[model samples]
Target: MTSDKSFFDFISNGLPGPELRKDADNAILPARKLAFSRFRALGLPSVKTEEWRYTNIQRFLKDSFSLAQEEGTISAEQLKLTDIPQLDSYTAVLVNGRLQPALSKLPAEGKVTISKLSDAANNTQLQLWFDKHPHLQQQPFAALNAALFADGLFIEAGVNASLDKPLHIIHIYTTTGNAFIQPRHLMVLHKSATLEIIESSVGLNETAIAFVNSVTEIVLEENAELWHYNLQISEKNSRHIYHTSTVQKADSRYHHFNFTLPSAELTRNNLSVALTGSNTETNLHGLYLATDQQHVDNHTFVDHLVPNCNSNELYKGVLLDNSNGVFTGKIHVHQDAQKTNAFQQNNNLLMSEKASINSQPQLEIYADDVKCSHGFTVGRFSEESLFYLRSRGIGEEAAKTLLVNAFAFDITDQVHIPALQDFLSEKIRKYVSGAINN
Candidate 1:
């Protein structure tokens, strides 16, 4: 464990070398060393940094934390805290980022392979695509994660393979003391393969602070399609920074859904997609609801490198109490990407006078033939809408909940899974009711 002031010095002074991890493969050792060098060069971001101007990350690192001394354990009863009702899918359970096969119901082994990153060190896909996303190059936390991450899930779907149901990944973080945890994951879909994945998290440490930095890289081959949904609902003692990067090939489709609900002290999400091939389709949808003093930030980037690509993005936020929210979305169209159509919109509702939001939507188009647009709006909860609902005999609390849900319907309606959509609606209702009662 290191004191607050020594957090940076701890990593800088006692850096881990290849020999530290005897289990690391010779192939991955070079990549790890390179990543460590990159981290040293970039260091951590400060408030002065353009990308981090609104969020003060150093405040969260003031507390002392260990680098997760040992792997945490969880019983089946404890895992039930993260279960979503009516989600009939294969489940993969990870404790402290290490895959626990005994507690997981994995897909069949023929076409889909799911295993720990450490266990798959010698895998061909792992060697070829590990830490290869270009967007992560400039992110210091992501670079640090690449350098020191212990273990995480690795999935590879073969050509023409399709899962009968979605795959649910449950990430459980348990620590005896305050800890810093880094989890790394990679998913690859071969040509014409299709898959659906749902991710959720649970923190069991009631008294300790668990700061997690995780990275997931996805690759979609030609004609491949993938649906990804991330549900982040953790205890207030947890802080998280997640990076999800995807690379789409020709004619591929990538759809992503992100839902950030109450209680985490801090949550920052970095999502980026690189369309390297022509005729690719990308859809990004996000909804974040924060209460109390929680802070939530979402940063997204969509890059169109070739011609005839289309990308759409929509994000909605609801801030209550003294909570704060941030949204930054960027759509970039290269000169070679002619006939690209990209659109982005961010809308937020502040439920309390002290609540605030900072939104920046940007579009950088180099091709004259491209159609790109970005917009953002932030408004306080409409009293007129509340009064109209109350005039119809609805209670104050119920009226507020209805208005919030109605404002969020545009983003929630795009969810493809019926059960998941219902779960989100219920969660939104609960969050609104709790905030109003408080």
Candidate 2:
């Protein structure tokens, strides 16, 4: 580990000589070089940066960290702790960004292909669409991951293919020392194909800090549909930055659900979708629960490039103790995007006097006939509602839990998976009840 070193300097100077060019594949070297150059030019964001004004990321990077990919193992007992109660699906288990084939039960290889990104370097789709999304061009962290990511998953669904069961991906982070990990992935759905994917994580670092920077790029062809869910509930010693970029074609439907819960010290999510064809439907929903001194930030963008597209976005937050939260949602309609309908809303609840939130919702429209609107709201728990629940014989803790659940109902109700919905509800109740008791 490099002691008292900045993250930028550590990446630029401290890494081993061969670390930068470890991927010797001639076909990918050009892309890697371009991404490395971009990262150098953009550098790291500071407090003065417009997009990162609310979160001071430099504070988290001040500690010592190792660039080397550490080797760690997980037992069956430890792996079971990260499982959802009633999820009956094929599983893919990754530890420190490396896939464990023995621990995973991947889907059959008829029309669906799931393998390691490193092994897919010679694949045609991997060569054509990897790291080519427009939304990832300007993100520094995304560029960094593209240049030096260790290993990740690659999934491709054939045309008109459909999965009978959902796919659950469990990410377990265990490290012997302070480390920085980067995982890069790409998923492509062919025309008229459909799939559902759920991602969750767990951290098992007793005394060391583990920071993860991950990027996942998705592509949906004409008439395709995707149901994507991301659940973040790592330990207190973990920090994360995630970027999910999706491109939608004509008549495609995309539904995304994000739930960020307790214990992680810092979490930042950047989600973006670009509509490239007409008559596409996009839905984005998010719910975040932050306690203690934790910090969570969500930034999203929807680009309407073609006509007859509809997009809707809603994100809610519950902040307790001295936690902080930030939300920024943007919608852009191009001149050719006639008949576009876009709506965005962000709402937050501050349970403690010291808890705070910063929200910004924006819309930019160039088409005169389009319908676009955005809104933001921040408030406390309604005293009247609490009193009514209390008067019905419910104790204070139970009343508060019920109120929080009711507040989160809008986002959770949109989940198509009944088991996942039940798991999220139980998690919310347990966290709220424990916080109130403390």
Candidate 3:
């Protein structure tokens, strides 16, 4: 059998030509070539890599997978078979990493601007926006994504505009069980603009095997407010590597809500947020559940570049069976960040003897007047709490469910959106019940 290294070889040797960039209007090819070179110079992470010590990603890699080189035909039937239940939000659909414009219903033209990457690439303003963001060459997966992404959603809200409903982005993969794809999304909110974004997925089973490298870039101008939520749930044989890079300006607010549920064979998420302006507030809350042999990892870094930027993070996870999970978070307070306030904590629950977690939370403070603290905990449910539930006539599974639900609430309840919160609650309950039943 071919080894995991073959996957890298396949991607590096298969870079496409200008036809792939025909609609991109030559705006992305240069970036794509640079990223491909970066990937070749610095290969995939190994066990020796400090950031990847906990997860053995090579075991999940394979050379048999094909790249989704062209748009896959999506039937009307496939459009209706979405994993996420319908919600009161604007919808944008992508099939096999290609935008399905006919199936997508965007907001009115003047209120906001939402278009496919190919169409948006022709806009001079969008090109300038891309030129101003941070470099993706530092992260191998991100570089690979940039090299391969053909199309994605580009959303920009005008200054002082407030979206009445959230924007829902649904990504569906279905070329072949053994094909890989990279999806990219870009969002920019002008000054005083407000919006909510929800990302969800679909179309996979245990027999499925695929690789997904995706990235989302965001920019928030002065006084803008953004609420982002991600629901990542995939099949047992699927591997997902996703990244989010965001920049916040002065007086802006950014809130993140994340839920990672069962059955993905491998999952890694990288989140980096830069507080470029003072008086910015950022909050991150997440819940992850892993069972069987699923492996999940979340790494977050917040850079406090200016004074008076406040950032807080709380992540909780439940691991059952032989599943493994990892959490590593860091908050940086620069010399000029005199009034920075940063706090980070990761709490995990191990439900089986073989279940394990590797958690590390770090704080780097250079300013004297900053308040920064970080910590982690890995433990089982409290015996007394479980006993009390059982004493109240609950069965073993029921008691465990009650306790797990309460533990997850510590992070889930912090989501202010009522409908989204309710949906997440039901999803978590179903995942917990499935784990106990298995």
Candidate 4:
């Protein structure tokens, strides 16, 4: 095997061409190219690189993949397969990272405004935000997305507009061949606006090894409220990587819940939240279950850049067979961020002896008046709980399943929508049943 440094260098040097770049108000060609150069300079992160020690992308870098550009259509029949419950509300559809107008159903009348990125009349807002936040240009995968993305969905909620229905965004990855798809999403909520966004990803082909690299940027104005959900269900041979970043203003509230089920080779998710104003609140909850030889990694960062901010994070995972799971979370409170309240916890359950989990929860508090705490735990099913259930007439397999479901209920129950909560419960039940049969 080639050394990690050499491998990253090889992949970085093979950056895609900029000839067929997408047309944006302010072309990101220069920024994207500069990011590629920075990526080459940094190379693949190793154990020495504190942020990447637990989740390694070296193997993925060594693989050969091509970026997809041409729009591949998915028939209405194929789109029907992704019918999400309670989807009568506003919805946006993207196939192979390109927005599908005919496939999407938008709310006829609502405070929410949804339109195709290519057709949106908010070029001024886009340019201003992108100019002020060039950090998006520096993100490796995000830069790749900006440079290659053809079109996506752009959503904006007017000031004080309280959406009565959730907005569902479905990303369908249909494999024409072995290729990589980068999907980009931008959501902005004006002051005092309330919005809920749901995202789901699905792969069509089982044998094709496709890469799904996605990026979502959210901006919340003062006193805005946002509830976000991300659900992943991809083919066994497909790989999915995601980066989600959020910036909140004073008194804004942001809540996120992420669910990752079985997938193919590997899946990594990076989520970050920056509280740039006072009295901001943020919460993150995640659940990941992987079986077979699959690997799943979840990394989160919360930066309290101002005073009187608060954050809470909880991530749990279950690994069966020879699967692997990882969770790394960091909460940072700046010196001026006094009175910040931050808490983080990661817990995992390993079913089989071969299953493994790596968890790290960290806190960096530069403010002496802050309250921050972090802890992690990794263990198998409690024998005592299992014995108690079995003694009450439950079968061995059923007892185990019950315990696992109970452990996952904490996060699943947080889904306020009754329909969504029930759907997720059924999914968890099926997953446990399959594990027991194996």
Candidate 5:
């Protein structure tokens, strides 16, 4: 365990090491410097920040954390010890913030390339993508992530190729007390390529406070298809901040699934998708379960930059105990984005009187021909349904479980992968049952 230290001092001490990179693109060095400058200018965010008004990060800054290093406390074998059972796939194991290549396995037939970001940073195409979507200036954490990401995942699929198995990437935290990690992941799909990726985060124990800051960027070219899933369940006392951004070309399809368990004390998620071309189809589905004093917040944005794009988003949450949850989703249609079809909905089930959820769903349409609608709902278990279940001789605990499961069914049902759906369903069921038992 480390002593309490200031966050500014920590990041400043760590920012001077990346300028000497040799294998990376010449532009990446300058980009890192720019990102660092942006971070220094932004500094730590206060509640005054509109995007972070509800969450207070002051406490996390006050405590000292073991920032990720090349050396890890655990080995590849240790990564297998996790909450989520392993599924059949090529797995990439990341201990702390560094990629363990010895433990990672790529897909058969060499149809895909999964390697470290440093190894691929010299690629001209990847450099172009990195330069086009450089948005590290948006927030302080994002800037820090850009400047300090230790190692990242790079996946590239050829044109007209489809992967036979999904790629499962797992990130584990093993340092005691508080351990901080910042990782970067980038995926580029050529025209008509298809791929599936799953990112899972886990910690060794509940006593330590693990802090993970990760950024994932994905690009789908014309007619490409992608299914990405993020399943995060850290220590019971941890802080996690994640950002995922996607860009879809014409006739491309992108689907994203996010499942967050209640293990962490504080968690925040940012999901953004840009419809760069017409006839693009985008779908976002998320489910978060929280209990005890946990706090989880999710922010999402969908931009219809072109006309004739369609996006569908649905998020559901079950909050129990004294936990607090926040969801803010925005759907924006540009003035030129006519004939856009977008729908956004957020629903929450407050299982405890003390539990609370703040939901905000926004829709901005500048085009007359756009069909965009956004709404949110927050309520408790239906007493009518409970009564009916009780009348059928079901126990109170069992009745509550059934009602909660029914409320969460819609979100989990949207998961296209059967095994992954079952995995998420079991996690949700455990949380629901725990809330009743506690």
Candidate 6:
């Protein structure tokens, strides 16, 4: 094993040189520099790192990926929003980490406020929020994002506001060769607010392997209700890594649904929910489909820090061909968290002998009075069901595809938006068709 010094030398001198900020550095630059120094001290996460054991970052380090330069160009019509569902509602478009105002369309009601992160100097409230959330400095990728991120979006819902239309944020990556893009977003829902948000990631160009490291933070105040949906559909040569954190207040309800389908290399997702007030509720659902030589990993943590909090999580995956999948979930009931109810479950379907899956569900209950349970299941398709489908004159391939789709329905059905549901269903069908043809 190489020493920490060796890793530092590798990143600072080896491969492509570290990118320097040429434009005017923001007020956060000094703090971000300190964060970079911290990242240097920590180095890349290896198998020795418990949180990164299943997903490796060594290969990513060796690759010559640099912060994207503002040289690429994309058109509004070329963004391919036509295929996306629920796009007629309020929408924001970002290409290669830069917000495209000309391509974006806002709702007519004007109840919501949207602006670029680069222009946040005038927003004192957002500035205060950033000051309070210095935890972003501890994250290596997030630190890098802070230092290099060019543009992002900030969304706020007024108190007692209810948005009839969902807000969709689209990030499109169209780099030619190997490139890296980091997009940051912060969302705030005030007291008694109700909002729906949809986030989608897409990549074009097959020759270059793109890396998208994104972070999003959501804050829900008292009695706020939020429904969030995330859809990731990158081409065969793209890698995606995401970190999403949520903070909920008293009587708040937050629900999240994530769908990951069709990526070429590796993808990792870290989702954390913190219940900071009493009577908070949270629900999480995820579906991942991997085929060929792809790899998908999900890590989730739920912290019940207050009394009378509730949380439930379900994650399912379908692994076919030589693909690999992993799920690790932990629910922590703090000492002060009395009357907490938490449940977690992970299920996987292996379609080929070479396919692999790893599942770990854990619960740490410091409060004896809390109710928490976790379970996992891993298996292949049911032979009895296959036989029944065959007896009904359905072709073997078609029957298998149908069963795979049915297995995915549990998570896909959770998407309440009609357009999004249709879009996701179509993508799943395409993946199933490809798996059958293979």
Instruction: List model 4 lDDT by residue over 64-89, tens digit each.
Output: 66554547778878787677665555
lDDT of 4 at 382: 88
Query: Tens digits of per-residue lDDT for model 6 on 217-323?
Result: 78889999999988888788788888787889999999998888886577888788889989988999999999998889898889898999999999999998899
* Lowest lDDT 10-residue stretch of candidate 6: 14-23
For each candidate in turn, give its C-alpha RMSD to the true structure in angstroms. Answer: 1.8, 2.0, 2.2, 2.8, 2.7, 3.1
Clashes by residue pair, model 5: none
Q: Which model is ahead, 3 or 6, in terms of TM-score?
A: 3
Clashing pairs in 4: 236-264
In candidate 2, what are the lDDT values of residues 153-227, reduced to their tens digit? 898999998888999988889998998888888899999999999999777787899998899999999999999
* Decoy 5 TM-score against native: 0.93
Q: Count steric clashes of candidate 5.
A: 0
lDDT of 3 by residue, 1-438 (tens): 134367667786567665665644556677777777777676777777787788776666634777655466666776665534547888888876667768887777775788877678876656666523563546777888877776777888889987778877778766545767787888889999999888876545346576777888889999999999888866566688888888999999999877888767788888889899999999998788999888999988899999999899999999998999999897888899998899998999998899989888867888999888877888987999988988989988778877888899877778766777777777777777788898
Error of 2 at 10 (Å): 1.2
Better of 5 and 6 by TM-score: 5
- Whole-model Cα lDDT of every candidate shown, in order: 0.89, 0.89, 0.79, 0.77, 0.80, 0.77
TM-scores of the models, in the order given: 0.96, 0.96, 0.93, 0.91, 0.93, 0.91
- Of the two candidates 1 and 5, the one with more favorable TM-score, higher being better, is 1
**lDDT computed for candidate 5:** 0.80
Candidate 1 has a TM-score of 0.96
The predicted structure with the larger TM-score, 1 or 6, is 1
Quote the positional error of residue 124 for candidate 5 in Å.
1.9
Lowest-scoring 10 consecutive residues by lDDT in candidate 4? 130-139
